[model samples]
Target chain A: MPQVTLTVNGKSHTVEVEGRTLLVELLREKLGLTGTHVGCDTSQCGACTVHLNGTSVKSCTTLALQADGGVVTTIEGLAAADGTLHPMQEAFREHHALQCGFCTPGMVMSAVDLVNSNPQGLSESDIRHGLEGNLCRCTGYHNIVKAVAAAWPVMHGKETVAAE
Target chain B: MYDFAYEKPTALAAAVASLAGDMDAKALAGGQTFIPVLKQRLNKPTTVVDLAALGLVGITVTADSVTIGAMTTHGEVALSAAVQKAIPALANLASMIGDWQVRHRGTIGGSLANNDPSACYPSAVLALGATIVTDRRSIAADDYFQGMFTTALEQGEIITKVIFPIPQKAAYQKFRNPASRYAMVGVFVAKTAAGVRVAVTGAAQGGVFRHAAFEAALSANFSPDAIAGIATSADDLNSDIHASAEYRAHLIGVMAKRAVAGT
Candidate 1:
């Protein structure tokens, strides 16, 4: 067993894991953060997306050892400490972005990272292109694109908050 | 994935030493492909050497060429302003690989080392006549790739960097598989001081190779119309469910023409 230390959601934890344990497994099984879904064990689906060192990566393919001494942020860590929703989450909720809610966490996480990367602003086509990695079979991605487009203004501080 | 001893060497020499000592050791770069292969149990190495800690990342641009480290991710290469200024076509090619998440994790070295037949990097490497720098020596791109899923790298030889000579004009056009996004037929055309080179990937059974007739036609006229009559034979090409060998051969001409016209 290897002892791996990582900071998740502004908290540090040292845990023991097998050499083959993936980062998603550690988050879901070890830390009890199950919001990160495993839609596809392969890297095709972006259901296991998480921010590793401030960049979004597929957690299902990342080894636990690879995240040692790194900062990780999952979907559970997105909201404020007082439970206020993130702008992206608020937009998703208001726009009815999810159907069964299976891929919302990964979708929101990847969207936040995408918004962070693009500080200027995101257009409708940009939102659609950025959502290519994430697959949502239920909603047909119409509301999802709308939600991401709505969050861009709030994320860039151009707007106060997402409208209800 | 089988349990194996993991080693993360901070220094390049130590990583190479650890790999040379164990016959069944595998060097892990970005792990974009290696991790999926391991999860499928396709490979079972006794030891997995993680090369993330090694300081083998960065891009250097000189007057005549650009040298990129092995650990540089596709995202980094695609976003690098220097790479974009020096070789916008290479940056465009890198940006079209996989997707946002895959680009963030996939490294150029791992992609080149794996040498997937449908990969986009090999065509650029072959057409540009780049040089692959290893710990021991430098190997030309012509000699680096041997076949599909094969390279000329010796046992335990580590690729440190890849040096690509700047061309007067170059462009790449790829027809992607909708599911996996791998190239079904990709063409890279470049006009350098030496001559015009045309390399094709994803359609060949023997891996990426230069198209001699296309090259000759382009060298003489440097236009899409020059090679409009030239058609590659389908006898030696790969035929899969996604595309037939004859279809791929047809796409080669189409893509090559598009590349020339774009450039």
Candidate 2:
């Protein structure tokens, strides 16, 4: 077992892991951040998406050792310490972006990074193209696309909440 | 996913030395494909060398060519203003690769090294006549790719960067497999100072290869109509469940025409 130190969601934790341990396993199993779901272990589904050093990457494909000493932000980290949901999460909820809620966490996480990358704005096609990594089997991506589009303004600080 | 020792070397020399010292060591760059292969137990290595700390990530554009580091991710290359300015076709090709997460983690070097039969980068490299630089030597694009899932890379020969010559006109058109986003048939057409080059990927059974007939026709006319009559033989193409060999062969011409037209 190798000891790896990671600053996940603002806190630093040092833990021991095997060489084959994946970053998603470390986050969900060791750190107990189950919000990052592992829908597909092969990295196709973005259910295991997370932010590593401010960029979105498939956590299932990332080894724990590879992320050593790096900053990791999962779905749990998106909310304020006071419990206010991140604008993206709020927008997802307001837009009913999820069905069964299994893919919401990863969808929200990936959406936030997508919006952050494009500060200007993202069109409907841009949002659809950006969300290609994430698969929502239930929503058919209709409302999910709406959620990402709705979150854009709020995420950019142009609006407080998604329009009703 | 087997138990393997992990080494993260801070220097290129150290990384090379680590790989050379162990015959069973494999260098990991981005790990978009390597990790999946590992997880499936397809490859078992004694040591996995992480190349992230070597600072092998950057893009440089000169008047004649664009040089990209080995570890530069597809997303970075696609979004780079320099790459877009120098070769918009290459940038567009990068942008069209596997979805956002994969693009964020997949590197051009990794894609070229793996030489997946359906990969998109090899077509660009082959069409652009790029130079693949490694720790040991610089290989011309003509001699770099050998076959499917194969390349000219010798053991412990780590790719350092790739230099692509700027073309007067170049474009890549791909018909992607909806599920995997891998190219069912992809064509890259470039009209360079030397001549015109048309490379096809995914459709070839042996791997990416240039279509000399299409190249010749386009060289003479420099238009899609010139190569419209050129056809690829289905006998030598790949046939899988997603696409028949004949269909892939037809797509090769369609995509080549689209590439030449820049549509």
Which stretches of candidate 1 lie above 4 Å from their native place? none
Q: Give the interface-residue alpha carbon RMSD of model 2.
A: 0.8
lDDT of 2 by residue, B108-130 (tens): 98899899999999999999999
Clashing pairs in 2: B1-B38
Q: Against the true structure, what is each candidate's TM-score?
A: 0.98, 0.98
Per-residue lDDT over A1-164 for candidate 2, one digit per residue giving the tens place of the 0 to 100 score: 79889999999999899888999999999999999999988888899999999989999999999999999999999999999988888877887888899988888888999999999889999999998888888989999888888888887888777345
Give Cα distance to truth, residue A95, candidate 2, Å: 1.0
Candidate 2 chain B: worst 10 consecutive residues by lDDT? Answer: B223-232
Best by lDDT: 1
Report the number of the highest-DockQ candidate. Answer: 2
Two-chain DockQ for model 2: 0.83
DockQ of each: 0.81, 0.83
lDDT of 2 at B18: 89
